[model samples]
Target: MIITKSREEIELMRESALVVSRTLGMLASEIKPGVTTLQLDKLAEEYIREQGAIPGFLGLYDFPNTLCMSPNAQVVHGIPNSTPLQEGDIISIDCGAIKEGFYGDHAYTFPIGEISEETSKLLKVTKESLYVGIEQLRVGNRVGDVGYAIQKYCEDHGYGVVRELVGHGLGKTMHEDPEMPNYGQRGRGKKFVEGMVVAIEPMINQGTKRIKQLKDGWTILTADNKPSAHFEHDVAIIDGKPELLSTFKYIYDALGVTSTEEDKFRSKAYD
Candidate 1:
């Protein structure tokens, strides 16, 4: 069943979501060549604890890390390791936090040093597809609407939309009802209602949509071994519209990048 959060519950969720947003922002400056994903994971664990929130990913599924650090061809669920990131490589950091009986989950893909123009375009299109999906998360819309928007946006650019991994509803648990896929037909699936909150993520591959899992039983990668990008956001329906509970502004601030892309989804107080 789809769980609808009360307004107060949504506010509590926003707080938890910001904790993760801030954690990603702090790591944004530390993501550079020679830095290991394991090191970044340690930093995230400490930071999340300092915020008075527990690391949502750690110990949840017998996972040993605080963050899901997938790099280059790895799609998602990549375990953090001692391997140092190199120039032109991109890493997707998916994080979660538990606070006040609620959970917040979000993710962002970062580039190490400078990347190829082709990879840069891939990142751009993937992120754009994320917002396109978010725009479909409104009252009376269905889960497939969001998926269709994301798939159409990325496929038109010749990118492959991952079929296996899908986004999910977020609340007290990391994963909840309403599986939000990246590819589907419009007007299908469960209908979205007011007070519903979910994590809408798009995992787009640069090659074929097929994927494979490594021996670790955690890491997922593109079957063709090509690069992929993942972006996510926590959103809630309020007043019959989608409101962002998580913001990438903190990450953008640390990287010295300015954007008003989120302005349309936020309230005046959030600006």
Candidate 2:
């Protein structure tokens, strides 16, 4: 069953979401060539603790790190390691946190430095598809509506939408009801309602949609050994539309990029 959050509960979740958002913002400047994912993980842990919230991913499923640091061909759940990132590579950092009895989870894929034009376009299209998916998360829309939007947007650009993994509802628990897939048919699955919040993420690949897991049993990679991109946002239905609980403003600020893309999704109250 889908759990609808009260306005008070939604605000609590927003605080949790912002905690993870701020953690990512702090790490944004630190992501580059020669930096190890393990190092980023350590920084995230310290920052989250200082905020008075526990790392949501740590020990939740026996996962050892504070972040899921997936790089290059890796899709998600890649354990942080000593491997130093190289220029032209990209890494997706998925983070979660719990504060005031609520959970926030989201992800962002970052380029190490200068990347290939092909890879750059992949990231661009994947991120665009994320917003397209988010636009479908409005009242009266079904889960598939959101998935179809994402899939169509990416597939039109020759990208593969990951089938095995999907987004999920969020609240007191990290994962809740109504699995949000990246690809599906419209008018199918559960219909969205007001006060419902979910983490809508699109994991798109540059090659085939098939994926494989490494021996570590955590890392997922594209079957053809091609690169993939993942972008996520925490969204809630407020006043009959989708409101963003997570923001990329911090990331953009850290990276020195200026964008007003989120303006349409925010209200004066959140400002």
Candidate 3:
């Protein structure tokens, strides 16, 4: 069953989402070599609490950390550890926060320091694939449309689209109905409607799509042990189009990067 939000409730969700967006922005400048994922995780917890919101991922499924700190070949759900990131390496930080009784979840893959040309391209393409997927999350479209868009963009770049972990609807509960896969056929699965919100994430691997779980029962890594990238955005349907509830603007600003790629998806009223 789909959970539709009223205009007022959607505004509340936006507030919740911006809290997460701001948290990631604050963490952007602090990410680099010699910093452990555990350290970053700790900072995230404190910051979210300071905002009067609870860490959504903490203890939700017995997960110990506030962020899923997956690095290099790791796909998602990687537990934070003492391992210090090295230059040329990349890590995906998947974060979730609950505020005003709503949950906001999204992710971004960051380069540890200066990355290689190939790895940088992988990150670039994977992120691009994410927007491609979000563009499909409009009214008159189905879940498969979103998946197919992501898969087509990533596979065409010789990347492997992860099949196991898919995106999901968000609201009071962390994981809601309508699983949003990264690969599927058009016209398949549930049709999207206004007021419906979902997290559309694309987990693209540099090698085969196969994955495995760590002994810790949390981290998921690519089977080929090759580098992978994951990017996500929280989207909602409003006025029959996809509106972004979360933005990478803060991250971009903190890193001094410039891009107008996400402009089209952002809400005009909020602008």
Q: 38-145 in candidate 1: lDDT tens per residue?
A: 999999999999999999999988998899999999999999999999999999999999999899999999999999999999999999998899999999999999
TM-scores of the models, in the given order? Answer: 0.99, 0.98, 0.98
lDDT agreement with native, every candidate: 0.95, 0.93, 0.92
Candidate 2, TM-score vs. the true structure? 0.98
Cα RMSD to native, each candidate? 0.9, 1.0, 1.2
Best by lDDT: 1
lDDT of 3 by residue, 74-188 (tens): 9999999999988888999999999999999999999988998999999999999989998888888999999999999999999999999999999999888889999999999
Checking candidate 2 for backbone clashes, the offending pairs are none
Candidate 2 weakest lDDT stretch, 10 residues: 262-271
Q: Write the per-residue lDDT of candidate 2 for residues 1-271, one digit (tens) a residue.
A: 9999999999888999999989999999999899999999999999999999999999988999999999999999999999999999999999999999899999999999999999999999999998899889889989999999999999999999999999999999989998999999999999999999999999999999999999998999999999999999999999889999998888988999988777777763332
